[model samples]
Target: MMTLRRKLTFLVALAAAIPVVIMIGLTLKAQENLVLQAKGELNLLMRTNLAHIARDIYALCDTVNDVVAKDLDMDLAAARRAMAKCGAPNLGVESADWDAVYPLTRQARRVPLAKFMLGDAWLGQSRDPAEHVPVVDEIGREADCVCSVFQLMNEKGDMIRVATTVLDETGRRAIGEVMPAVEEDGSPNEAIAAVLRGETFRGLATVITNRMFSVYAPTQDANGKIIGMLCVGKRPETIASIRKAISGIRIGKDGYVAVLGGKGRFRGSYLIAPKAEDEGRNLWDRTAKRPDGSEHHFIRSMVTNSVAGGGRAIHFEHYPWPKPGVTGAEIPEKTGACIYFAPWDWVICATLYEEDYHAAADKIESTMTSLAVTLSLAGLV
Candidate 1:
């Protein structure tokens, strides 16, 4: 027969081990399920957010195009002549001529060119108020008026440089006299060389100085010639505002949200305990070697393409997160996140932590196991 102490010890050990083992298994299973669900929800959120962003961008682009077209059709000669004169009569005649040119001229004239001009202020690059010129002068030189968003800077003696060209024939010549500015980088010729060679230019390009992101839409005129491109750029504050909005969303107590770019770059987030360095960094090209040398899991979902206003999905690999077990873990290295491309070719994605999201479930599982053990002990007694 076993000694009393040994018997008691055996019973207590069995009671504790069984519940603890069961609890751990249950907790792991619950965590996995919760994580999967959370991922689905995150993808849905991303899709919705992307749709809204695309809609707003397209609307803004349309508005800018209409505004430019109307401004170009007006009596630009009279406007310039009026600016030369210091009185409102020239201004009035100019305004009347503009009204006669287009039915929408009256409304267009009332609309400040300052609103559509690309510089810090509607003033373009000119510091002298008297030297104020229409931004159209810079826009009309291209085969198409579609040019990337650029900074208008003073080249010399307060002469502002117009970096891009516009779509008008006569207006193009006028741009030379009125603006007399050249591209800062002198690469416009190279950038549009393919288009000049009768090739279609499709894709995203950035204006280096302002770090402005724009989508170039190719379009042709009645002559089957690619006359112009429609260029749309997100405002400086757009991404910042998106980041702010995502940060405000609350998922569970520990759950959070993030907006990853189609290339799996960090765009914005509402993560708890998020890495400080990950913000505002592009993750598309840097996925193979993260600082931590850990594997990361990223979800790719097709959302919206800014340029075409369509949907597309594509997969990206070598995400930056550390694997469950990896040695020499340093700060998470930048890696390419996965992207989902849909039929429309828009991409979307998100990242999440499994443990953080299922904390509540883990606690609940622990409590239940403890209660079950207590009841088992009482019955044994």
Candidate 2:
């Protein structure tokens, strides 16, 4: 038991284990620090991206509103006349005449022309064929005003209905009026509703569906009746184009970018893997649950109450899962993930295999292990 060879072997083994343990501990600490740093960097990048996206959207809305407002004066009387004369043969009108009428019709002040026309058509009962007539009638009666409805051709060369209403300046009882029925989808109506409710609705970046961001704003008429809404919308392709452009910019291996809503919902996401579903999913709904019935610490950090203000940026964590719009705390962890939030409730999140982001640390740990083994062998020799 007291042999010199045995004593020497024990001493060498102790020495090797001590350094190896120390090396491993230090490596782990460094890795943790690196990961934290990476997370911070990614969050910052996400915040910046969101700010830019918001700015662009606001600008686009402004441009559209300005163009429409300047071009058409929000006239109800002219819209009424046009509706009455719709489908009249020859209409005895030229393109130039139609163009001339455009400015005059747009310039008319808001009035109850549609309500009067509707009452006249239905004898105040239900003359209009559209099912939305009742709703339009209700809006008209409540607001006591009317607005301008525009006819424009879509990419499909089909005529589309677009309407805009400003606060009534005249002491008229018309709140708003519906445009003549057009063939396009009802996205424009949704957009107008959002504006009326004081929400910002803008085109989002996604090719699969038309995405929009809704923000709230106040409305006031000449009599301060707050008669209706003015909303602006563009194609979702606007945001998709931006995301595609950013993808061309390199970050690191597996590096990506995303745009989130104030509610931490995915407005736009760019990842290596394709997404299964698109639109209307919330990020906070996803991150709060785990498979083993245990909650992830990272996701819990991102939850918070809604804040006021139009465009203030904030920072927080995100948990992905629950599939956006899910209610309650019971979510599967396989559905949970962590992300970072920026001001304005914009979020950017990323998760990849450890090797993708920490290659350098991995290599260093491997080298240290080899050194530990070599030292132990030399001691035996």
* lDDT of each candidate versus the true structure: 0.34, 0.35
Using TM-score, give the best candidate's number. Answer: 2
Candidate 1 per-residue lDDT, tens place, 37-81, comes to 665675455444434443443344345445543433342333323
lDDT tens readout by residue for model 2, 272-372: 12242543444433334457888664422433321223334333333443323558866422211123232223333322223333455565556655665
The per-residue C-alpha lDDT of model 1 at residue 368 equals 57
The Cα error of candidate 1 at residue 240, in Å, is: 2.9
lDDT of 1: 0.34
- Candidate with top lDDT is 2
